[model samples]
Target: MNLDSFEQLAQRRKTVKVLAQDSLPTADCRAVVQRVIAAAGWAPFHKICSADHRVEEQFSGIEPWRFHAIDADACRNLRSHVVHREAAGKIPAMLASADAMIMATWLPNLPAGGLGTASDNESFEPTLGNVEHIAAASAAVQSLLLAATAAGFETYWSSGGVLRSRELFDLLNIPTQQRLLGAIFLFPGNVTKSDKVEIAESKLRAERRPASQWSRWVEVKQ
Candidate 1:
């Protein structure tokens, strides 16, 4: 995408807090959720097999954190676990009630004996078969995100929770061979900076690495 297009999408996509007080209409929410999913369905992705992979059904009254468990498990498998901070059954709603939602999960048919590094270090390299599959899955999710933004919705991708939990993979009915890629949440809310809530300064700021750190990895030829 062009810089102008990327900036517009980035500005529109904000990570809104899934406040307990805020609520979304069930029926309307479901419709867009389906659309976001359908868009991903239309995107091209690797055809990986899942011996036991299954996503939870759409059930009313399910909370947001429950969905977080699934995300949690996925992250754990990838050696990037997020600390659990809430009870079960509280996550689905956060997803269902969102303005829109997007997800990147391993579909059935992934090649057997997926790849991984000795440790989490140097694990991002695509040489490992599974890692390469995940990279492809992420690309597909990016398509879904951009499509949602183009359609006028805010979006954010989260691989923090489920990238590593094997049990979660089992619960989601995902086959032992398949892996969960990522999840994205989208909202119809406005993205202006003025509407943001102030955070306590006591919170530790996240450190960002400069792009130069990875410049050597990029192939540049004169």
Candidate 2:
């Protein structure tokens, strides 16, 4: 795509918190999800290790993270435990109306000196060693969002608290070594021109400073 087209796509991409009244077409939702995730996998990652290792093996390899897609039924079942009454009440309708919810997780890399058979959470350290992997996972999430926007789908990246709970990890059978980054909600609705202003206003979207404000070209002086 040309520069203008690319710019348009970037500008067109917006976080869709509130979905439209209609639900996504079930028949095509899976295909759309697959395409977006495939695009996410294409993100440039620093692959320091292989992912095809056994559970017993020490996971020292730094590979791209994994994404899990949860359907409406499962989302509803999980949302039942939401503490906030208003949020809980809104979840079913929101989840039912969306195409799917995608969970992004950071895989833990086992240290060389094996920590025995202890759980991942107990053994793993969120230090500089795994920082690159976390950055790669964030890139993957961005790619997925861009791909969904290009495919005429609205997307929302939410932590939602529920996804981070221990209950969710157990329910999803996610390993303790893996850390959930956040959840992405995919909707079928396209934000119209008229609705764009309203949505932007509702969120009080922050103004971003120009590159001049954040960028630097400097020489070190001690």
Candidate 3:
């Protein structure tokens, strides 16, 4: 795509929190979701060094990040949990309104000792081992969101507290070793255009720092 077209696409992409309660017209929303996810899989990943003794001897293995798409019915099932109960009213509504919710998870490289003591793991900076994987997964999510935008879908990325609960992991049949990054709700855009008004109002009420405010060009003097 040309630079102008790319810019337009970037400008058009927006987070849609409240989706209209309408099923996507397409007979196969799953297929569309799969396509978006496939596009996401194209994101570049930094390979973990297998040759390093620290990794080869101490670490188990690295698994690629994965995505799971949950439909409304499954979302409803999640409401039974206490963790989900507090947001029960809103959570169900959001789930019911959206066509599907996609979850991104990071499967960490376990220690050779296999889930060693928390203190032992903490000292080793176990979280740091998955940094590259998380970074790649984030890029994949961005690609998925952008693809959904191009397909004329409204999308919302949410890091709801309930997502971290063990109940959700069991419900989704996600492995205990996997850590959820977040969920992306997808559905048809608001036809009444009221959502856009809300978005505009939100932007008006918030102050966003421009790139110049946070970025700097570094110069080195030898």
Candidate 4:
């Protein structure tokens, strides 16, 4: 609740990618993932839910977002599926290392007189409701990342790569109308950052703009 603690939490979170061979015990991963999800669910959102999506009862009625999680064993299976299917793009090697991952999706509010059959080509509806829904869902995704970081687990917010494909969607049984926002990976079992560990870090990770450059003071004068 304190500002200092919040600042420290923010500083601790970062994207880290590890090789497929690196992994944590399934038991530790499962427990840590549960806590991480509990933390993520606390993110604020303006709207409650979308009319089209059927959210699980266990989620406590949060409607804009839905998460499909895969454990370490599933992660390995997905990695195999990715390679076997030859899904294009920079396939993640960390799939082998990750103990768990959640494919986070947002429900898009359809326009008036429009059906909910959204496709990849249909990026988004230019409606106010849709915008708010997307933003809320995105907030939930950030919450997931922060929660994972708070657990002292290595996390990666991936752009979804093959995880966004139709094949994967059908495999996970995620509803078609929902849009994929992020693929969050969690490497548990105290995977501390080490110099010897070969990780996939962004080259621009160190380049950060100061707050003054990114923010400004505004005033309305008579």
Best by lDDT: 4
Please write out the lDDT profile of model 3 over residues 1-222, one tens digit for every residue.
899987787767776665333322323467777888778778777865222223332234333566778765555444344323655334544554565778777555666775443231122234655788678778878888888887777777777456656666677776555557778877656534453222211353247677799999999999
Per-model TM-score versus the true fold:
0.50, 0.73, 0.74, 0.86
Name the lDDT value of residue 48 in candidate 4: 67
RMSD value for candidate 4: 2.9
Question: How does candidate 2 score on lDDT?
Answer: 0.65
- Sort by TM-score, top down from the best: 4, 3, 2, 1
lDDT of 2 at 70: 77
lDDT of model 2 at position 62 = 43
| Residue 128 lDDT in candidate 3 | 58
**Over the stretch 62-107, how does candidate 1's per-residue lDDT look in tens digits?**
1111122223223222222122433323234344334543334543
For candidate 2, which ten residues in a row score worst on lDDT? 193-202
Which tens-of-lDDT digit does each residue in 1-222 have in candidate 4?
Answer: 799999988888887877544333454377778877877778777886655455455544656888888888888777777765565344446666688889888877765565444656136677777778778878888888888888777788888887887777888877677688888887763555565345666667789889999999999899
Candidate 1 has an lDDT of: 0.43
Order the candidate numbers by lDDT, best to worst. Answer: 4, 2, 3, 1
Q: Residue 15 CA error for candidate 3 (Å)?
A: 1.7
Relative to the true structure, candidate 2 reaches a TM of: 0.73
Candidate 3 vs candidate 4: the TM-score winner is: 4
